[model samples]
Target: MRIKRPVKVFLLGMVAIVLLWVIHSYHFQNQQFQTDRASTYSELPVAATKVVKHAFGEVTIPVKPQRIIVLNDISLLDPVLSLGIKPIGTVSYLPQYDFLFRGVTNAEAAGIEIVGIGNQPILEKVLLLKPDVILMREYQRSLYQQLSAIAPTVVIDLPSLNYSFKENLRFIAQVLGETEKAEQVIAQYYERVKQLQQLMGERLKKIEVSVINVFTDGIIATYSDNETYNQVLQDIGIPLIPALAKQKETSLFLNIEVLNKYDADILFVMSESKNAALSFSQNPLLSTLKAAKNHRVYTVQQDRWWTYGFLGVNKLLDDLFKYLT
Candidate 1:
């Protein structure tokens, strides 16, 4: 029953080594946790000021803003929502254009107050809200001084060149310290595009797509290079009709006679109202177009198709998936 001294000594040594290894591992992990916590806090100091270059020179903003007021530019709604931050006040769009606020199902539940309309924001209402930061577009420059007096105003200038929905989201994210979330959102969006492409197969490359808005007055067709919806379609690998190849400075209002030139394998018609759809359908040339004849013409909501933002793009994608697939 006697154990060998040498074997017992070796066993004791092994036990000591294992205990030391466990303690070292625990201390290393604890130190690593503290280091990570310190790094995160350092990156986001309370009351930290970050200088952001916007449309109107440079402005310093808090690293973490509590109350944000989004004015005029409803496009920022999507990015703000994605970042999981609620703005204290926002400008209201027209009722017909409610799709601009699509995906925000519980605005009332979340306490998002509409302070005013895009063109005419009620400054008195905004002043009551007392937002910490104000986000707006350059077009609202007239109200800059007043808004700045109320809070730190950051004006986002729509970039003329290489501007995409993702770029816009990144700008908003940078202001809110949600750059990581912005990247994730962009990646998820492209992944959805990839899924749609897979479902579409070769048709994604060969199909000619056209996006046009039907109004009582006339039709406005958009080109791929400039328009946000068309740009997304181009990214999904759909080819644009030759007529839409050259970018116009703005959306072109075409008469019915020239509408046939822009006909495509698939047509997305953004109708202003039910009457507009009816009128567009009644056009004599409607039956002759390939998309119309084949029943591939989709009557989409004008707001959902025209609005420039992450949510709008995703809604457009949803419609494409519903119809094309």
Candidate 2:
């Protein structure tokens, strides 16, 4: 067991170096472990158990979403709020559409920040929130890659551009994990429709209904038979005029001459804006129509028609039915 002094000293140095290396490695490993935990906690803001697929592809719906960023579609806010979840941030639209925004007070009370996400939403602003989930519409797929990089994104498909209320509500319900809620809402809506159907069933069955949207310049636009307005009317047992049904199923703009061409028992006019309303109401050309002469013409605001929200649709339908009756 006897060793030279030089060998003893050299061995001691070797042992010291190994001990130092071990300590450094331990600290480094501990720091890295903490960093990893922080990364998980920070980036993923919710306790999620499942991922759901929607019309906009797939998203991981958190067990409870805490920081939801509604990018551009404020219309979807009502359903989320109805499910008892409040969004942290939402985009700002015109005041006329405030009926669709449900979580404004909760967001304000939470000190939630609202950045200018733009009409299309901004990627940098979205990334800053570190959102748990983002909701948009199917038409905004162009931002998919950029949004996905920041957080889970879900896009709900509307009933259609031509407008289908049933499909819009169904898809939105699927995205919110509220297929049952959606069903319930739809069921209630159908019940109302059935009542209206009974009331106007025989009358509408005999007479055709027509909806025309008029702009400031006397341009007349009519809804396709597939549009949500038409769907609602049809569900209530009303039928569209043959000419409108035969026309292409899209948002169509025609001249004032369309009034002479399509003879409808009831005509609903949609004003594109305030100015359009002023012009359409006073147009000498429109005075010749039976609807205009009998003062059966009704003007609907464009914002309510453009937004596809559950509550919004119900309100619009209620108003329409009340007027019709």
Candidate 3:
């Protein structure tokens, strides 16, 4: 009995030592884990950001966004591409009419995926892209919230002005912190315009140019000051028909019976359908117009003719020189 008591006491002492050792090791390990975690996180640098105010609301965005996605082609993508930043993705309604966009770089060839048709975007593709920023026009009011959830989205509600491209380009530049580049681009564009003015000389002031649209449904109409061709014509000191210059609406519907109302010294038709263009050209009444008699009535593609903004205007200049010179 005396030996048993002594052995029990010795065993209890050993057990207590073991418990103490275990507790010490666990505490040391937990502390080492915390220290390592903090050290690892501290090694990475924080990303810088800036706040920008847009049509929808203010949004905080990374200063130099690595990935950008454009939702609207004509209004949004035009300016984004004009600023020289190739987007990660964009939406185009007419992929077949990509010649208008070739000035900026072929969207697919430049690695810009078509997220969806027209202004609509594929949310799943957007999520996979992990874009740092998204640019769009206010035409996508329904999609603003949904896109913002994925990234910092800036919506541009452009005013309906004849010279809206300047404002559009400047606003996009401000959003991207590219004001200097914008100014440079603007200067370059105007320099080209100046060259055109010098090349065309006084003939620009004499000839009355007009843009008409022949819809696929056989509707014939002429564009007013808001059209890209009109904008470029005005910039180069070209005279537009009185009906087009004074008109407020974007398009003026004209009855084919009174084709004289659509007459101009030089006429450019934006034909959406081959059949409609053929019918318009074959109409006996068209021969009565001075443009047709002089062989100055040209049929143009809607996508190429309607594209607006910096690169778009430059493309128009290329066409103008082809026809006029």
Candidate-wise lDDT, in order: 0.78, 0.67, 0.79
- Candidate 3 least-lDDT 10 residues: 100-109
lDDT of 3 at 308: 56
Question: How many pairs in model 1 have backbone atoms within 3 A of each other, for residues 3 or more apart or on separate chains, i.e. clashes?
Answer: 0
Q: Candidate 1 on 142-190: residue-level lDDT in tens?
A: 9999999988899877664255667888888999998998899899999
Query: How many clashes (backbone N, Cα, C below 3 Å) per candidate?
Result: 0, 2, 0
TM-score of 1: 0.80
> In lDDT terms, how accurate is model 1?
0.78
TM-score of each: 0.80, 0.73, 0.82
Number of backbone clashes in candidate 3: 0
Query: Among these predicted structures, which one has the highest lDDT?
Result: 3
Cα lDDT tens digits, model 2, 15-77, are 999999999999999999999999988998546546777776667777555678776533565
Q: Which ten residues in a row have the lowest lDDT in candidate 2?
A: 100-109
Winner on lDDT between 1 and 2 is 1
Better model by TM-score, 2 or 3? 3
Order of the predicted models by lDDT, top scorer first: 3, 1, 2
What is the overall TM-score of model 3 with all chains considered together? 0.82
